[model samples]
Target: MSAPLIVGSVAYTPNVVTIWEGIRDYFAGSPAEMDFVLFSNYGRQVDALLQGTIDLAWNTNLAWVRTVAQTKGACRALAMRDTDTVFRTMFVARAGSGLGGLEDLTGRRLALGSRDSAQAAILPVHFLTRAGLTPGEVDFLRIDSDVGKHGDTGRSELDALRAVLDDRADAAAIGINTWEAIGRDELMPGALELFWESPVYSHCNFTALPALSEERATPWVEHLLGMDWDNPAHRPILEMEGLRRWVVPRLEGYASLFEAVREQQIGSRW
Candidate 1:
């Protein structure tokens, strides 16, 4: 068989399985011309993208920034989900815990989502630094779920939520959609409260090395944007990802996130 499209991303199990299979199904109608592969983390996924083991990838904001920096913008953002826009990361605490803001986190144990998470870790650290709180000043524990997906893996956020529920942490960092997903699951809705929210930024988008020609890339992205959210075939996937539709790709929407990752470089050791 010809080479598969070699999609790379984390497997978010029941909630995010739609991300992989849904995109595959969308491309399946193209005369069976493409196929995909999934990865558990974004670091390795990006490595594969650079090494040519994969043709394209669904990259997190941080990974896209790294990809652009590494490739000098030789890669391209193909498409993204509509819900990926206006996304925020939230700081949460147990109800009645009396925590007012990040300042209160001083000397307290805080649960961060993932080491590679943009929302839960990167941006949070950047904002924290802006507020004059440096890393290692507080007790920071990481709930590492989707390493390569860069905390788009809701599993890490879920772990932080549970830590707050069980009284293990004074507060936790989580993506807003992940927090909402927990509410849908009836997980401690009233027991937890949002203490702080990061400014809006974009999330996931398709990143590919510049080898794929525009002729092939155009239809691949067009098919994704053209997916009908109301159609039965696409509805289940849309619900699973907490979105109504996908959108045309844009990197400018994520410039703030890229800048955050660049300025903070919290996990440069990685």
Candidate 2:
């Protein structure tokens, strides 16, 4: 049998290596083999998937939405990390900045993650609009180290937090999980506080081209869902991906978020 080509972004190479190694080991024990190609941006990754250069891609929800919007449902979701199913974006402030809530952010400087970060930038904008706020209403400072990986590299999130510490912004938008992870790092403590959280939304998933065969998809899905969390074999990768399990992909979970984004665009147009 031929090898499966996996496509993904390059910003998170450490985590990517973990995932690729795990997949390689899983498939090595099976009848088929797999390989991967890392791209620097989602546009290239999505384009490759569409042009059939890669059989499957682990894509962010934003990338998947772009794909579906462009292709009109020509792609299919295969599986996803359990952690990716529900994630929230958090608005944070310095521990004693006196910025009590979303309403207090008016005219205040705010640091946001990367421009392309759905969790830290896009969805936060949606939530802000719902809170009766607009991006221009505040001094928007951008922390843009990991642009294409969409905050998955943690660079943008960390920079946002540092901005809060340095008083660059009265508040910042960051991934909720990344905030918690850094807060527990023992090296960083009590420097920032969480003020608000965006409604949970889906994040990452595996996508397949319309022409992908079921025979190829089945083993990939099976191995993913069957990963033994309790066993030593899959522990490192699971920890790297921040998941204890994997689940079948579901596109419907993103409907509310998509609606919110679309509605926000409409409001912007007027």
Candidate 3:
């Protein structure tokens, strides 16, 4: 019998356990049996993937960028969630803060989530810089909550939002997911409003080294793509993971981040 395919993921929330368990159960009857290991952070998971301790990793954009850089573009992205393809960073402020746009952020206190978070921190700064608002142009109030987890926890984004609400900062940079979540859950209803939205970028994906053969990888990818979102058996896992369908990775969507990391001089080596 073939060994089970080992996958690594960060334990960002309790639901991670449920998600992976369901995936394992789903693959039990498939040709490619699967198992998972959870890490406290993405850095460690990325390391395991590079070190060949795990065959695949559920990597965030930052992790994926690092892997590509560290491997000199030799790594492969197998698939990503449908929701992961259209992610955007949002700049929000108190409903009546009078912030018109990115230009208005100049000389004002702007809060950001964990430094490593592509959506909440990295891309926000990147977008602001692209809009002519350099780091020195804004008074930054950075919240580094759940840093190593690469903003997967969303704790820092929430803190940044609270900072804006409490008058601690004039605005906050957060992921579109958090923005929608706040509306869906009615968390602090109407206290915040979107000041700006970033261009769309990709988020998370299944990354693997070149050494993982197509023989093993193809079956796994096929099984993931075969998941039926409408089926009751798969719906719960799909909802928990925040995607209705698995799609092939869009390499172009990652160009901004690749340039941002170089421009910002963020360390690629985990």
Candidate 4:
């Protein structure tokens, strides 16, 4: 029997262990069985994937961009969550700021998350620049509370919001997931209001180097895509992982991030 393929993922949350364990069990007795190893951060996970210690990596979009930069187009994305395809950045302000759009952000203090956060940091700047807002017009408050995880912890985004709430900033940029997680609009009522949001972009994916053969990779991806949302056994894991289904990687969704990373000159390591 072939040795089980090893997958790498960052332990961003406590429930990550449960999610991967359930996935491994689902692949049991399959044509391409698998296992996983958790890392302290995405940098370590990406290193494992590059060093041939892991056949696949569950990578954040920032990690994916770095991998492509490091590998020079030698790597390929196998699959991504359905939610990832439509991921977006949210710009919010305390209620009654009268900030309706990016154009209103000029001369305002804007809080951003970790420097490495594509959703909360990099992409927000890109969107602003595209809107013709220059750095001189905006006062930026950067919160690098969770730097190494690339804002996977969501702590940074939360901190950015805190800056806005505490009157340290007039506005904040955060990921849609963080916005939903906080339930700010409903729970906080008039505490905060979203004024601007970026176009949909990709968030995370299963990345693999060319060293992993298609014969081995294909079956694993097929089995992964087989996970049904309606299945009783798969539903909990799906819910915990925040996805309704796995789909082929939407390479187009990553285009904006790639451009942002390039324009920002974000490097692979923190």
Candidate 5:
């Protein structure tokens, strides 16, 4: 018998335990048995991955970029959720704020989430700059809540939205996930509208080091890709993890983020 594959993930929410436990149970009968450990933040998880403390890490876009940089492009992205692709940043404002687009944000107060959040902070700045509104031109009210979680908790995004509602900011940058969640939950019903949305980018993935050989990596990935979205046993985990299917890692969708991180000069260590 071989040792179980150890995977690392951030404890972004309480449900993380349940989610991973379900995944471990699903793999118990498979040739590739698996186990997981949770970290407080992505930084620690990324560090663990790079140090070979774990076989794999569930990484956000920012973490993935940092891992690639730290490894000199030696790391591999194994798989990602279907929802991880086509991620966008939304510029939101109170209805009738007269904010039509990014151009309208010039000289206005803009709220941003955590400094490390790719969609809410980094990419928003990149898009704004491309839109001809430099950071110096806008009054930024940044909320750093859950900075290391990489906006997985959505706490900072909610704060950014609150800033808009309270008139503390004329606009806010948030992830598409938070935007759709607000609609689904009827949060502040009809009080806000999208002013603009950014181009699509990648979000999260299962990243692994090159040292994790195909003998183990191959079976692990095969079992992960084999998860049936239609299976009753797998549906609960899929729903909780916010994906209908696990798809092959889409590396191209991360180009924008890779460029954004470089343009922003976000630290590669963290």
Candidate 6:
């Protein structure tokens, strides 16, 4: 028999090992027995995927776009979390700051997360541009604590929020996940409040090239989608992975990110 199918994921946190180990255990003795390798960042993971060193890559939205760019749309997005289907970016400022909307950002200071981040950085800029704000119109304060691993987005975005609270920036851009993580509009009356939110987009996905055949891919996807959120044994892993269930990727959900990448002239490679 051939070797187990290999999957690549970035080591974004210590618990990542636990998440994959639990998943590997779940696949034991299945028709598509699998193993995993962790990379330090999405760039290395994408490189491994392209070089055929790994059969599948768990990729962030930006990494997925970069992979598509490199493959010229030859790659496939196999699956994604349910949460990945409706991701959005939020432009926030201190509550009662009188920053009404995207247009209010003109000539104002905007703090952004890492330059590589799609939600906090790329899509935020795209939204600003859509509002007719040019590059020179907003004084951008980029806080890039977590540079490569697009995971742990909270770090940079939280810093951006601090920039707003401390008066360094008039507003900040961050993911909706980050917004919720901070308790949303109810966190505090005088703290952060959302001024504008980008339209929904997709997030992380399992990316594969043509080399990973359908024969090998089909059963794996089937078993993945079978992860029942109600099953006590499956619940922990599902919760840790931040999804109730895995589903076939929504290709259309990536359209905004694709547009943003193209408009920004972002290179195909990370």
RMSD of each: 3.1, 3.4, 1.3, 0.9, 1.3, 1.1
Tens digits of per-residue lDDT for model 1 on 107-177? 88888887788888778777777778877777887888666557765778888878878888888988888
Which sections of candidate 4 miss by over 4 Å? none
Q: Note the Cα lDDT for every prediction shown.
A: 0.76, 0.76, 0.92, 0.93, 0.91, 0.91
Query: Candidate 3 lDDT, tens digit per residue, 67-175?
Result: 9999999999999999999999889998888998999999899999999999988888888889998669998888998899889889999999999989999999999
Structural similarity to truth (TM-score) of each candidate: 0.85, 0.89, 0.97, 0.98, 0.97, 0.97
- Top of the candidates by lDDT: 4
Alpha-carbon deviation at 208 in model 6, angstroms: 0.6
Clash number by candidate, in order: 3, 0, 0, 0, 0, 0
Q: Model 3 Cα displacement at 181 (Å)? A: 1.3
**Better-scoring candidate (TM-score), 3 or 4:** 4
Highest TM-score: give the candidate number: 4
Model 6 clash pairs are none
Q: How close is candidate 6 to the true structure, as a TM-score?
A: 0.97
Distance (Å) between predicted and true CA of 245, model 3? 0.7
> lDDT tens string, model 2, 149-223?
767787888888788888777888888678777753345556777777776778888888778888878877886
- Candidate 2 to truth, TM: 0.89
Runs in model 6 deviating more than 4 A are: none
Per-residue CA lDDT of candidate 4, range 113-187, in tens? 998888989999999999999777988999998876878999999999999999999999999999999995889
lDDT of 1 at 147: 66
